[model samples]
Target: MLFVDFTPPAPCVGDLNNDGVINTADLAQFLGQFGQTVAPGTGADLTGDGVVNTADLALFLGRFGQSC
Candidate 1:
């Protein structure tokens, strides 16, 4: 038997709520911050442009349902 320790990356993208999963909750949070300049650490702005817009939403949607 072999047991190798593996650590996942920190702060997975698309995980707005930091719940380790990208789902409706993240989508809801994104929608809530849509068209607004959210803070840098909010994670709602997928594009990292300080603002949550269609482009960011599109990017987020592409990664929907993915697990961190």
Candidate 2:
């Protein structure tokens, strides 16, 4: 028997609000958690460092205005 790979598409890094787009609303969502230690695997923690910092901010900016 052969098994096929079943990898799921990764979530959009900058779509913090998970609204199918990366925009001001996601920006707002990110800002709301800025400087805080976000929960593990949370969108606000873009860098996945467990904290929402400038790194995540920069990443968010880079992907802003993108559609999921």
Candidate 3:
């Protein structure tokens, strides 16, 4: 017999609201650390344009909290 343990991993993004998924909420958390250089990740890829920058931040904020 083989035994397997199943457990969900911790969220890589911080979306405290837990609205079925993480996106801008997580980005909002990142923005708090803006103007300070830091490593990049999914939340930083706001516009999905293959880079992180002010434009992505603006796009994220512009459409925050609106379900698709």
Best by lDDT: 2
Better model by lDDT, 1 or 3? 1
Query: Using Cα atoms with residue i matched to residue i, what is each candidate's TM-score against the true structure?
Result: 0.77, 0.82, 0.38
Model 2 lDDT per residue over 3-26, tens place: 997988788998977788999998
Residue range 1-68, candidate 1, lDDT tens digits: 99887876666778888888899999998888888887754668877778888888888888899997
lDDT of 1 at 12: 74
Best by TM-score: 2
Model 3 residue 8 lDDT score: 75
Rank order (by lDDT, best first): 2, 1, 3
Better TM-score candidate (2, 3): 2
Q: What's the true lDDT of residue 8 in model 2?
A: 86
lDDT of each: 0.83, 0.87, 0.55
TM-score between model 2 and native? 0.82
Look at candidate 2 and give me any clashing residue pairs: none
Q: Give the per-residue lDDT digits (tens) of candidate 3, residues 1-68.
A: 99887777654333434564446666666576555444444545544455566876676566555543
Better of 1 and 2 by lDDT: 2
